[model samples]
Target: MTLYNNVFETVRMIEKEKLDIRTITMGISLMDCIDSSGDKSRQRIYDKITGYAQNLVKVGDQIEMEYGIPIINKRIAVTPISLIASASGEDNYLEFAKTLDKAAKEVGVNFIGGFSALVQKGFANGDRILIDSIPQALSETERVCSSVNIASTKAGINMDAVKLMGKIVKDTAYLTRDRDSLGCAKLVIFANAVDDNPFMAGAFHGVGEPEVVVNVGVSGPGVVKCAMEKVKGEPLHVVAENIKKTAFKITRAGQLIGNEVSNRLGVPFGILDLSLAPTPEIGDSVARILEEMGLEACGTHGTTAALAMLNDAVKKGGIMASSSVGGLSGAFIPVSEDEGMISAVQNGALTFDKLEAMTSVCSVGLDMIAVPGDTKESTISAIIADEAAIGVINNKTTAVRIIPVHGKDVGDTAEFGGLLGYMPIMALNKFSSEAFINRGGRIPAPIHSFKN
Candidate 1:
């Protein structure tokens, strides 16, 4: 009877609260595909990815139908292109990005990540080449996503990479201006990036990861929000407990889907990322969860405290549900992706500063936000620096995915269809950070970093 009741409850959550398997991401290592010739390397990569992921979408669809679960995406992540393409001594990696895009299309995945570089401490020759090619690569490829890890808790922040990314972002914006500078939407700059993240535009197959693995990302902000409504006027502790229980249920469901997918593909199960990723849908918003906690708006005075408790409870509950829980296992606050966040920004209830502050307690940082096209590159770099400092000091994974929509400004809307959503361009400070960003050097790791 109890098992039947639980199944019925889960069905209700799926029908009414938007519970979903956000993605089943297959991570493939390209380390073995490197060659002295760029063409050979590209061919090997294309063949490996398509061969491994050929049945990924088919299997995902089968499980979704068999179990009546909604799997939103079937995606792929590969070893950082910089590490593989560097062996070819290529001056540019545009063809590599195209190869990834082609492989993704062949496999029927929505996106393919890991056109990436890791230069937290310093640059490798391939890192510079990959970074240089990012703007053109992103502009030309329809499905290639890119990232750069420029900071880490132990390695500190790489300001040179940060500065370069700002200009790269601007160039991407210029190249894709016809599409509201959508190229910037596919790029992420990170601090303390995770090895097993199943989400994009920051998901990459770390060198330490297995040859091939299947990782699942689960999302249910609406489920948690609905649960919170049940305990309205209850003490904060009760709210926290309810959220944990809901999260536990969500995580368990995710593990079932993940294990099934892994077995079908003959790949190892990587991890279950139970992050409360939001969408532009009305009920499926993380900001709505915070508002349900008694705040008048999502960015009010107690917003950070509420978010801190919410993030902690979600992690605790997910940990209890599965030992394989990993990735950014907390609430995400991407502005354009969450309808409630977009409303809050338009109502003046949420400011850009408040969004940055909230990121200190949530999952990722400055995601899917649009700034004015005329905003200086130095300002964008400074924003990345601030978020990196927060992540480094706190020993957490944080990232920036801000978009400067060409010819768009405050009060203007940038349309990025589908799950990417749309947003009103938010205002930025007018002050210049040119002199500060010009000082290209590393910021040393925190004092507590030397735990060895």
Candidate 2:
């Protein structure tokens, strides 16, 4: 009887509030596919990916149909390519990316992640090669996403990798300038990046994960916004409680779908990421949820507090709904991806600095924002360093995925159709961080991180 009641409530949420399973991501380990020969290694990588995820889309669709729920994306995350390709002795990792892209296309997944390197402490044999190849790899591949972790609460920040990534981001934008610098959209630099994240541009099968697993990212900003609207003029505690209840319902739906998909695919069920991942579509914006909390607009003075509450309430509700809550389970405020966020930026309510501050409380950092074409690499590195510092000191996951769109400036829009959305290029401070970035070394972990 309770199951039936919950199903009916879920149906209502989907029908009216735009709740959805944002992604069904299959994590596959490619550790055994390594070979001294790059070609052989890539071939095995392709085979393993295609073999494991062949029915991923089909099964996702079937589950969606049976449950009358929307599954927005089907994705695959493999073991980090740097680890798998290190044994291949590959100087350049573009072919390996192509293999992953080919496998993704063959299996009909939206994106394949793990073209990545984990250099939070320092670079290893293949880390440099993978990091160097990111620009070309992302430029040449359509369905491949890449991430590099250069900072962590435990390992401190690698300023060298941060500096190099700034140049790599600029190069990626230049290479994909014809597509509104779409290549940069597929890349992310992170501090304390999680292995079970089902979201793109950062998802990767961690070394400690199982051979294969299924993880789901659930989104319901609309649902929470609607719930908040019903309690207008209420106190802050009331608003947070409302959001927590709504998040509980949304996460219950995700756990059901994740369990069903895992059973169907004969894989272990992983975490359910209850992130308020907004899209450009109407009624699906996280910024709107913040607005519903009585803010005139997002990025206003109270925006960060509102977002902090939203993120915490969602995590609290989601954890109670499912014991296996992991990944980035909070609210995401990507500028381009959320219609309200774009509007706030265009309306002069949101600035780059404000977004940086908001990320201190939100799930991800500086996501899907566009900067001027001529933005210097040193400035970009500085932006990354700022975000990483927040993540390190606060002991949380933060990432930067800013695109310095080539040949675009403030007031000009850089468009990438569909969920990638479009955004007016944002202005950056006219300053240089060359001297600071040139001092390449580690930013030691915070004193609080010495939790013994």
Candidate 3:
């Protein structure tokens, strides 16, 4: 059959080129778990999550081995903790977060997101408490993640919330200053944040979505690299076309299984997050695709252009294959999660500047990056400031998730192990932004920021 031939060709492409799927995250809404009584809230929330996700990890492992493709992470995202805290108080909200963390460990899941607040226009009592508790909650928990929506298209930019988040960023750093005090690593201040995002720290179950759903995030950096390797001298458009075709095929496979699993579990099926999520696996890297595209290295001048092309082409193909395509459907450049990127940073092929540039055009910001412990808190704030400026100006979702490895300096290796790959502490530009930060009030929204 023609389809069989296509499968064979794709397999051969995999043999020669390094291609693989990154993750298949299942988004589950927990709005129904909300309780009328404060004392019973935590128990209700935990019961709901554990019951729904009991088979999540088992199913993911089965699917991965069945297809002979690597599924890097099996993650879950739920309703924002703020809404879950409604009519409740800070004490109950923190309890709810603890429930989320405990259930994740009990079910053998890695990361559990949606401990967040949405205050685009203004803050509700629950939103305010949840946002305030972010630093303490993140500092205390190992597997919990959080994000806050401060701006959106339907609502104007919330300057007050942004200012508050800015202050909270500093406090989080100060309080948790012990573990690299990178508590802000688990928090993202967002604009136009999407619900049903399988990626963290922005993912959450939307009110409009189903009760439980499985969303697949398919990646094929190796596939793209191999395709690019063959079409070396082709025009950019031609190369992008080949990349789109590959993205379409990979997304289709994800869609197929996602639907099947959802049906089998008697749950509503969700969209396929067609992001080129990478991993520590050798042939499964977005940076490797960039390298294969003749960059020699990912942190070079041509990095952003290539990433933009790849990001766009991937969306174009994936959108056609699945009508429900959502989440951060683009290339992910998590430095500590991708082996090629870690190697590049170690070998002097990648730098902080290049990563910042790539973030402007890629899906997220400097995600999962590890920096020297000697880097000052101001320096960390500066990094957040830089990424926030990018999001504020370009109006894209840019965030900073840099880890401050305690007792590690530049060139030192920090091993998080597993999917959170090892990263060498990268050097930062020894420049002074101290005075500017000291004078921080608020970087008012851009004049053209009004998109609504």
Candidate 4:
């Protein structure tokens, strides 16, 4: 009887509250595809991805139809190209990115991640090549996404990589300026980036993951907000409890779908990422969820505390529903992706500094934010450094995915359409961090990271 009731409740959530699985990401390891010859390596990479993910879209659609649930995206994350391209002694890794894009298009997936380099401590040969190639690689490819990790709790922050990534990001913006610099939208800079994340543009198969696996990212900001509406004027504890209960139901649905997909595909189930990923659609906003918790608007004085509670309750609920809960399992506060966030920024209620504070507790950091076209590269590096410092000190994952839309400024809108959404250019500090960023050295690991 309880199971039946739960099913009915889930159906209601889907029907009226916009609950759905955000992504069904297949993580395919490409370690064995490495070859000294770049052409051979890229060919093998393309073959493996296309072969493994050929039926990904069809299977996702089938599952959606059978269960009467919506799967918003079918995507793929491969082992970071830096590792594979290094074996080929490739100076330019654009061919590898093209291969990933080709494989994704062949399989009909929306995006393919892991054109990445891990340089949290220092740059290796492959890391340098991949990092240098990111602007061209991303500019030339449609479905390929790229990331570079410049900081981690264990190894500390690599200032050199941070500085370089700033220039890379600016260059990418210029390369794709014709398209509102959409290429920067597909790039992420991370501190302690996870391997099994199903969300892009940060998803990548970790070095320790299985050869092939299925990971799912479930989202329900609308559901949570609707649940909160039912308990209006309730005590804060009661509100927290309601959010937890709603999260449990959302996560259970994700686990069910993940298990079925993994079984059908004959691949191991990786993890259920219960992130409250929002969209531009009405009612599907993380900012609205916080507003339901009593904020006049997101980025107000109480926003950070409210987000902290919301994030904690979500993790608590999701963990109980799935033992395999991993990746970024909390609320996401992407500025452009959430309608409420976009509104808040436009209304002058949300500022860049406030968003930074909110990210200290949210799942990801400084996501999908847009700045003026002429924003200095050093300033961008400073932003990455600040976000990275937070992640390293707290031992949590944090990232920066800001876009400097070329030829756009404050009060102007940068439109990308679809799930990429649109954003009103926000103001920046307008200060120079060139001296600090130019001091290229590693920041030592925090004392708390010596837990071993």
TM-score of each predicted structure versus truth? 0.99, 0.98, 0.87, 0.99
* Candidate 1 to truth, TM: 0.99
C-alpha positional error of residue 347 in candidate 3 after TM-score superposition, expressed in Å: 2.8
Question: In model 1, which regions exceed 4 Å deviation?
Answer: none
lDDT of 3 by residue, 183-253 (tens): 65677767667777777666788777787887777777777777777788778888899899888987887
Compose the digit string of candidate 1's lDDT tens values, residues 111-224: 999999999999999999999999999999999999999999999999999999999999999999999999999999999999889999999999999999999999999999
By TM-score, who's the top model here? 1
TM-score winner between candidates 2 and 3? 2
Model 4: what TM-score? 0.99
| 180: Cα error in model 4, Å | 0.8
Model 3 shows how many backbone clashes?
2
- Whichever of 3 and 4 has more TM-score, that candidate is 4
Q: Roughly what TM-score does model 3 have, to 2 decimal places? A: 0.87
TM-score of 2: 0.98
User: Local distance difference test, per candidate?
Assistant: 0.95, 0.94, 0.76, 0.95
Question: What clash count goes with each model?
Answer: 0, 0, 2, 0
Could you report the Cα RMSD, in angstroms, for every candidate shown? Answer: 0.7, 1.2, 3.2, 1.0
10 residues in a row with least lDDT, candidate 3: 13-22
Off by over 4 Å in 2: 1-8
